[model samples]
Target: MGVLSICFVSFVILFLISLILFTIGMNFLFNDYTIFIEWELVSLNSSSIVMTFLLDWMSLIFMSFVLLISSLVIYYSSEYMFGDIFINRFIMLVLLFVLSMMLLIISPNLISILLGWDGLGLVSYCLVIYFQNEKSYNAGMLTALSNRIGDVALLLSIAWMLNYGSWNYIFYLQTMSGDLEMSVIGGLVMLAAMTKSAQIPFSSWLPAAMAAPTPVSALVHSSTLVTAGVYLLIRFNILLVDTWAGQFLLVGSGLTMFMAGLGANFEFDLKKIIALSTLSQLGLMMSILSMGFYDLAFFHLLTHALFKALLFMCAGAIIHNMNNFQDIRYMGGLSIHMPFTSSCFNVANFALCGMPFLAGFYSSDLILEVVSQSYINMFSFFLYFFSTGLTVCYSLRLAYYSMTGELHSGALNVLNDEGWVMLRGMMGLLIMSIIGGSLLSWLIFPTPYMICLPSYLKLLTLVVCLLGGFMGYLISSVKLYFFNKSLIYYKLSWFLGSMWFMPYISTYGLISNSLVLGGTVYKSMDQGWSEFIGAQNLYMNLVNMSKYVSSVQNNNLKIYLMFFVFWIIILVSMMIFV
Candidate 1:
C-alpha cells in the first residue's frame, strides 16, 4: 500500500533474517555442517564453534550488535520520519547496509569480505546525503572518496594474499610465517584498515559525517561502520602477529587514543565530541588487537556497542527534543525536564568513563590488565594507563556539561520527549550498557588468568570520574560569557571546542606539500610545461596581435555569406563522411 507500510514490512523481514542467522550461529556453536549455494564453497570446521572461522566469536558478537542497533534505528525512524517523503528509500538503504555489514562479518574470503565492505561504504555514502542538503551532500562526497582509498588498498591486499597464500581465510593464518609474502600482504591490508578505522590521517571524514540525522550518526558511530576497521584487525589478528605492522598499529593506536581524548576535551558540539571519542575508543581497541588480544578487542567492541550506542541515541533524543541544536552549552538542566533520558544518558556516560562496576569499567579494566600482562614492556603498559585516564576525562566531560550546566536563555524550544519509538530504542540500549560487561565476561573471555580488580583501582576510577565531572561543570559555568556571546565569540568557541579540525589540518598539509613539491619540480625543469601552455605575457602579446585582425572582422553582408558558405561546406563534408 503506502511507503511506511512497505518500510515496516522490510524491517520485519530484516529482523526475521537476523533471527535466522542467530539461530544458525547457535547451531554452529554445537554442530558442524556444509553449506552450499550455487557453486560457492562454504564449510564449517572444528573450533570452539562449528561455524566457519568467519563466524567465530568475533563476528558473532559484532553481528549480534549490528542486528540489534539496526533494528532499533528502523523502529526509531518509523516515528521520527513518519511523514517524510523518502521514508521507503531510507529504510531500503538502511536494510541494505545492515545486510552488507552482516555479510562482511561472515565473509570467509577476502574477496567476499571486500565486496561486503564496499557495499556498506556505498550505502553509508547514500545515507549521509539522505537529507539532500548541500552540507550533507558534501559530507557524503568526502566520506565516499576517503573510504574508497581504503577499499583500493583492501583490493590490492586481497589480490596479493590470493597470489601468495591460498584464496581461503584459514590458509592465510597457517601460511603467515612460512611465506614472506603473507607478511607483506598483511602489512598492506593493515594500511587500509588504519584508514577504515578512522586512525590518524583518514579520521576527518567521520566528524563531517555528523551532518546526517542523529539516528544515522548513532548507527554510524556506535555499532556499525566505525568498528569495521577494528573488526578487520580482529578477524586477521593471528596472521598479523610478530610483524612490524602489528607493532606499528599498537603505537599508532595509543597515540590516537591519547590525542583524540585530548581533542574531545575542547569540543562543544555534542556529536563531534562523541565522534572524536569514538576514534579514541577504537584506537584503544586497536591497540589491544595489535598486542595480540583479539578476545579483549572483541569484548571491547561489544561493550562499546552497548554504551556508545546508548550515548548516541540519548544524544539523538536530546537533539530531537532541543530542535536539533547539538551544542552542549545550550543544553542544561535536562535532568529536570527529561529525567529518564538524562538518567539513561548518565549511566551510559559513566559506563563510557569506565567507572567501577559499570559496563565500560570492567571491559576497559580487563583490556588494560591484558595489555600489562602481555607486553611486559613498560612503554606499552603506561600508554594503556594514560589512555584509560583520558577515556575517563572525556566521558565524564561529556556527561557533566549537558546534565548540570546553566540552561542557555536562548536555547531551543523543548518538548517533553522524543517519542515512544525513540524511547524504546534508547531504553533497550541503556539496559544493555549497564549490564554488558558481566555478560561479556560470562559468554567470552573465560580465561582462568582473568582476575577480579582490587578495590583500590575501583576507588581510583570513581575519584577520577568525580574529578572529571567537576572540572567540566566548573568550565561550563564559569566561562558562560565566552560560551554564549556574539557570532564571533561563537566562532571562537567552536574553534576552541571542536576536535574534528585535526584531520582537516592533515588534509590541508597534504595538499600544500603536494603543491609545493609540484612547483619546485616545475621550476627546476629545463623544458617548462608552463611555457607550452602559453604564459600570461604571451597571452597579452596574442591579445595585442588580435587587434590587427579586428579590421577583417566587420559585420557585413559579404562576411555573413562567407561564414554561411563555410558552415555549409563543413556540414557537407560531415554528411559525406557519415
Candidate 2:
C-alpha cells in the first residue's frame, strides 16, 4: 500500500510534466525538425540493424496520452488494490506496460517496434493472470496467444520489408509505397493490427480478458495495448491507403463494430459489457482509418481513452463496493448508494453512446457524418448506423439494471462514494470526459468538417438511437417469471448472449480442430508406424542377430577352428556364387 501510494503520486507527476512538454512540441510541427535518437546494434559490410527513436508531434501527443492514462490508472489502483500483497508487482507491471507503449510510440523502425510490441503482449499476459485463478489462467492464455499471432505477422512484415535493404521501415514507407514487396509488408501489417485491435476472428480474447483485474482491463483495453494496432496503422497509413488490404480492413471493421454492439446487449457481466463497448469503438476507429481518415481515427483514439479508462474506474468502484460482484442482475439502484461513481459511470456511458457535447460525440459524430457522405456501399452504411443504434440500446439497458432499477439485494453497504483516492482518480478523467472531445477537435482539425447530408440521414443516428434506447428500457422493464415457464426463444437468447457463438468458435471450433488433427498425426506417425519401423523394429532385429551369434559360441579351440574353417569355406563359396 505504501509503495503503490508513492508510485501513484510519482507517475502522475511524471506524466504531467510530459503532457506539458508535448503540448509545447505540438507547436513546432512546421519546423521540419525531428529528434532522431539512433544507435547501431548489429553491423556488417552489406547490412545492419539499428534502434531508431523518432519524435514528432504525432508520437509526442500519443505518448503523452498513454502516460497520462497510465498514471491515473496507477493512482486509481492505489485504493482499488489497497491491501493486496502483490500490489507492488502490479504497479511494476503497469510501469513496464507503459514503457512498452512509449517504445512503440516513438520507434519508427520495425525492429525497434517489435521490442515494444512483444513487451506489450508479454506484460498484458502477466496482468491478465495476476489473480492466479483458473479463469485468469485461461484468459491469459487466450490473450497472449491471440496477440502472438499479430507478433508473428509483424515479424513476417519485417522479413518482407528486407527487400528495401534495411529494417528501417520509416525511411521507406514513402519510397516503397507502390512497390510489390512493400505492398506485402503493408498487408501483413494490417493483419497484425487486426489481431491486436481485437477485430473479428481474434475478437473473443478482448472480452475474456476481463478475467483480469479491472485496472488492467481499463489500461489494456483503453489506451495502451489494443490501441497499439490503430497507432501502428496510423503510422503506416501512407502504405495502407491505396491497397486492397485497406478494403479488407474496412469490411472487417464494420463487422466487428456490428458484432460488438450485438454482443453487449446480451452480456450481463458489468465489466464484460464495458469491454464489448470498447471493442465496438475499436472497430469504429479501424474502419475510419481504413477509409484514409487517419487523423479522425487518432482523434477518437484519444477521446475514447479519456472516457473508457474512467468508465472502468467507475466499474471498479462498484465491483469493490459489492465485494467483487459483477452480474448486473445482482445489482440495481446503485447510484443511490454510490453517487459519485454512478455519476461518473453514467457520464462515461453517455459519452460512450455519443451524447452531444461529451467526449465520444466529437469523433463518433464526425465518423458517422463522414461515412454518410462518403461513397460507401449500402452494407457499410447499414453497419455504421445500426451499430450506432445498438450502442445506445445496450447502454440504456446497462444504465437501467445497474443504476436506476430497484435494488435486487438487501446487502449492507460498507462505503458509498467515499473512496477519496478512487474518487480523485475518477475526477481527473471526469474533467477530460466533459470537454476532451471538442477540445481535441479544435486542436487536431482547425476547420470543422462540412457534412453534407439529407436531413433524414442526419437524423438517422438520433432516430435509431431513440428506438434502441426505448427497446433497452422496455425490455428491462418487463419481468419474466420463469421458475416453471419454459422459454420458447431460449435458443435465440442463448445465441445472442454467447456473442454469436464466437467463444465457441474460437475456443472449441478452432482450438479443438487443431488438437484433433495433431493427435491424429501423432498416433499415425509418431507412436504407430514410424516408431515401430524406425526404432522398435531396428532394435528387435539387432537383438535377434545378437542372440543367434551368442548361441553359436564353442568351448574347444580345435572344434572352434574346424567349424570356423568349414564355415569360412561355405561363406566364400556362397559369395563366389552370388
Candidate 3:
C-alpha cells in the first residue's frame, strides 16, 4: 500500500480506539476504578523486577487524547509531507513517537517510565533533525541535551526509590512525601519535570524544536512530548504540593509563562509564535499543578491539546500554501484567499485567548479564578493576570498580522485551502476545539467548582483580556512615530523579544566559553607543545637515528675501510690492555 493509504488506515484505527478509550475512561471515572497489571520480569536473591501498567481514568483519557491527536497528525502528514522521498520514514518515526508517549502514559514504574522517556527524547531528536539541515541538526542537539538533564534527574529519582526496594513510584509517593531523603527524590523528579516541560532555564529548546516538521510540532508541542512533564508532575502531585519544591516550581512556571507570552508578542515567525504560546500554556499547567490542582492542570492539558493541535494544523496548512514562508510579515489577507484554513486558524486563536465559551475559556478562566481566590503573594498574582493579558495580546496581534491586513505576500503565492486531506485533519480538531472544553469540563469534574469572589475580582479576567486585545491591535497597528520610539529602545525590545536572551543563555552563554577553552586546549596541548614534545618529536628523533644507522650500513667503500681500520685499532688496543 501507499504511504498515504497506510496513514489513513492508522488514522481510522486510532480514531476508533480513541473513542473506545474515552468511553471506557468515562466509565472508569464514574466507578472510581483503577486497574493495575504487573508481570514479573525477574526474581533473584530477595529482589524482584516487574513491569507494571496502570489503567485509570486519567491514563485512559489522556491516552485517548494522545491517540486522537496522533491519528489526525498522521492523516495531516500524508498531505503536508506528500511526495517526499522519505515519507515512509516520517510516518514510521511519527508512529514511534506516539508509541513512546503511550508507554509513558501507561507506566507507573519509574524504570518503565524512563524507557518511554528516553524513547521520546531519542525519537524527537531524530524527528527534529529530519530535514537534514544545519538548523535542524542544531535544534535537535539542543532538544536532546536539554531533555537529557531531565533524564538524569529521573534516573536519580529511580536510584533513590531503590532504597525503598522498588521502582514503582505510584505506591510510594505518599510515603516519600514526608521523609527527607524521599523529599530529595521528589526534588529530583520535579527537576526532571521542569526540563521536560521547558520551564525557566530549560525552556530554550521548545522554540528551537520548531525545526521539526509541522506535523511533528502539532504532535510533540501540543499533546505528547511537552505535556509529558506536566503529566509526570500531575502523577507526582501527591508529593509536590505544599513543599519547597512546589513553591519553587510555582515561581519558575509563573516567570516562564510571562516570559513566553512576552516573547510571543515579539516573534515574527508564525511557528515560533505558536511555539511560544505552547510554552506559555505549559507554564500554566505546571504552575497550577504545583498549586496542588492536578485535575485542573490535566483538564487544561486536555483542552489545550485539542486547540493547540488544531492551531498547529491550521498553521501547517497556511505555511504549506505560502510556499513555506513562515514569517508573518510575508502573510496577510489570507482570510480571503484561504477561507477554511483561516476560519480554523481564527477559532484556534480565539480559543487560545480564552474567548468566552471556547475550549480555552473553561480551563483558563477557571485557573485564573482559582488563582485569584488563593493566597498567593503579590508577585505571583501579577504574573498570573499580566500573563493572561499577554496571551490575548499575542493572539490578537497574530490574527491581525496574518488574517486581516492587505495582501503582503509575493505575486507568485498560490494561497488557497484546496488540500482536502489537510483540511479534514484540521476539521476533526476544529470541532473538538469548539466543544472540547465544555465536554472535558463535564467529564473531568462531575461536580462544578464553587468560585466565590467579589464583583471586581470576578471581572478581572474580562478586563485584562479587553485591555490585552486593545494593546495587541495597537502594537500591530503602530504608526511611524511609535515605531521610531521602539527603535530608540531597541535594546529593551530585543531583550524581551529574544525570550530574555534565554536561547543565548542556553546555547552560547552556557557553552561558548567552554568551547573557546576547548579550542585553546586543542591548540596548545594537542597541536602545539604536546605535539612538539610527544609523538611528533619522538618520531623525528627516531627517523634521524634510523638514517644514521642506514648510512653506516650503506656499504660505501671509504666508510667500510674507515670502519675496518677503527675495528682493527680497537682490537689491538684491547689486546695491549689485556
lDDT of 1 by residue, 1-578 (tens): 78657756755765676566656654554454434222334546642222233555456556867887777778777777777888878888888888788777777768778878998799999999988899898788778777888898888887777665444565557667556756876786788788778887677788888887777877788777888888877767876677788888888888778767767877778998888889889998988888787877887888888888788888888887887788887877788778888998889888888867778877787776555446346776666676666666666666667777566636447657648777887777887787878866765644545455567653554555566566555544546436445354666646544544565574456544655788888885533666655685588788887974674576678877887999999999999999
> What is the TM-score (0 to 1) of candidate 3?
0.90
Provide TM-scores for the models: 0.79, 0.88, 0.90
lDDT of 2 by residue, 1-578 (tens): 47765776766685786688567557744454578788888999977667788888788877878878888888888888888987888888998999999999989889889999999999999999999999898888888878888999999988887787777787888886777656888888999999999998799899989988898888887899999999999999987786788889999999999999988988889999999999999999999999899999999999999999999999999999887889999888888888889999999999998999999999999889898888888998899889999999999999999898666765574648879988998898999999999888887777677888999989888888788888778666665434322256778767777777888898788765876899999999999999898998999999999986876664668768888999999999999999
- Model 3: per-residue lDDT, tens digit, 160-265? 8888877888888889888866789879989999999999999999999999999999999888999999999999998888899999999999999999999999
lDDT of 2 at 178: 73
Q: Count the backbone clashes (under 3 Å) in each candidate.
A: 2, 0, 0
**Which scores better on lDDT, 2 or 3?**
3
Whole-structure CA lDDT of model 2: 0.87
Each prediction's Cα lDDT score? 0.74, 0.87, 0.93
Q: Can you tell me which runs of candidate 1 are displaced by over 4 Å?
A: 2-7, 16-20, 23-38, 41-53, 376-379, 409-412, 452-474, 477-501, 509-578
- Model 1: residue 60 alpha-carbon error in angstroms: 3.3
| Top candidate by lDDT | 3
- Candidate 1 displacement at residue 504 in angstroms: 2.7
Per-residue error for 67 in candidate 1, Å, reads 0.9
